[model samples]
Target: MSVRDFAHFIAIDWSGARGARHKAIAMAVADAAGGPPVLVRRQRGWSRAEILEVLTDGLPANSLVGLDLGIALPFADRGAYFPDWDQSPPDARALWSLVDEMCAEDDHLCAGGFVDHPQASAYFRRHGAREGARFAPEGQTGGRGRFRVTERAQEAIGCKPYSNFNLVGAAQVGKSSLTGMRVLHRLGGRVPVWPIDPLPGEGSVVVEIYTTIAAIAAGRTASRSKMRDFAELNAALANLGSPPVAGDGAIDDHASDALLTAAWLRVAAHDPAMWLPAGLTPEIARTEGWTFGVA
Candidate 1:
């Protein structure tokens, strides 16, 4: 489908915190016709379940939703999500299903158990003073530092993407990605997640996006990952012909990411090159899903 097919553009900055409401989660919406991207209010913060309901229940028809989270792991490295594990999933869908099943009983769809699992502990860096230490690998000093081919391809464009396997740092996106897998599991059959599932004949479509790529496309530098200044944020929005961000209090980095990403999507959605990058092969699409604006 084309960018004109959608009536609304929504960008979500998701959090993986194990709580009912998370202030880190931010959402922004913009009309396809062009206007300021407005932040969706959350007086008491936002819950993952609530966001899922908003998308699944009833939303504007033909909306393009951009979610800021890694949809899949670095499968191109070992050609599998979890190498040597008997329970290693073969594809992105299977990996999501396994994670959902493993953390099915956890509250708020948390994936703590998956990361803490004996078999999976070696794959991620755990929190605490002894950072970068890997478990089950027997005295390994550092956690596995790796990236998927798509991530490398994204880096080629000047955007630095964190490895989905690193979970210990402040900038780490591993936790969010793991929790997002559960969300993707529930979003199944409701909205077709781009790359993983083909674009639907009609209705909304969800695509994986890196807010940094969106920020860069909107003329922001790779070094300045966050935009707290109102002028800078609005200038980026103005570059896409979207409305400026106006609010009462201070706008945090998360909100700026969502807002700017929404604006970038408004313009980038029209470009066919983003939808079909040369690296997005049938194999990569099935194993490691491509980020929307990576190419």
Candidate 2:
């Protein structure tokens, strides 16, 4: 029910690159007592398999893990993740299963094929020139907004989340979301992902987190996308009652995100109201998973 219930808190800034290892991935952790969030892992090259290992191999019990990626598409607004498509999955779990099944042959556990699938391709903007395409074209990433209700709600509060439907661009999260689906599929019931699973008293709980939301909550609204400056990062941490992150050394956006989010979760996790958002009904939970700290 509160931060006291969990022993450890973590935030992972995930990457969706095609290589066997990705430098974009970063992780930070903090104690339940809520102190400064320390950068525990900064792997220049982390594979999806390696991350899976991190999740399972000797992880602390009763930990709250926050992953930065949309778990499901905006089914609440579009009526379906892929409207008129015969293979539209019934729920979040089924959707993950579908993505994993579709991209089963991809190398290094990549999910390039699912985004390029004939039936699903219409919904996602692929790589290459957009040519003013309404839907995400094959091999292209930019597209028009196709956000879910929660995403729209997040925008109202200034988070400005892009549709997972958009696979291209620095802001687009489509690739990571798809790849995360595969991770979720493999996680099975080992880690209880919040909103997808009931909030338990004790165990490792994975929840969706938006760094932007955490940033705003930490009073870093001016530094919208990334908190690169050391002063800004430390100020946000101070706002959350977290200690300063050591020296003014170079810190990339991903590292800053994981650090800030980890600190935010340390305090936000104590708010009992966070577990119950207004629109997080059974239907929404199944189709469009809720983002933690969005309510």
| Number of the predicted model whose TM-score against the real structure is largest | 1
Model 1, span 1-295: residue lDDT tens: 3634678889999998888889999999888877688889789998998888888985678888998889898877676777677888888988888888888778987898788777877677667643333321334455446677788998899887888877776788888999988988888768888888876767889999899998787777799868887888887777777777676446799999999998888888888888888899888998889899876
- What lDDT does each candidate get? 0.82, 0.81
For residues 1-295, write the lDDT of model 2, one tens digit per residue.
4534788889999887898877788888988865688887634566788778778775688889998988988787657777678899888999999999999899777888898787787777767853223364334455465787678778778877788888878878989998988998888878888888888778888999988988898886724658777887898889888899886856788889999999888888888778888768888987888899978
Worst lDDT run of 10 residues, candidate 1, spans 129-138
How high is each candidate's TM-score? Answer: 0.93, 0.92
List the candidate 1 regions with Cα displacement exceeding 4 Å: 1-4, 129-144
Pairs clashing within candidate 2: 124-136, 125-136, 125-137, 126-137, 126-139, 126-140, 127-139, 127-140, 128-139, 141-168
Each prediction's Cα RMSD? Answer: 2.6, 3.2
lDDT for position 6 in model 2 = 80
Error of 2 at 196 (Å): 1.0
Worst 10 residues of 2 by lDDT: 130-139
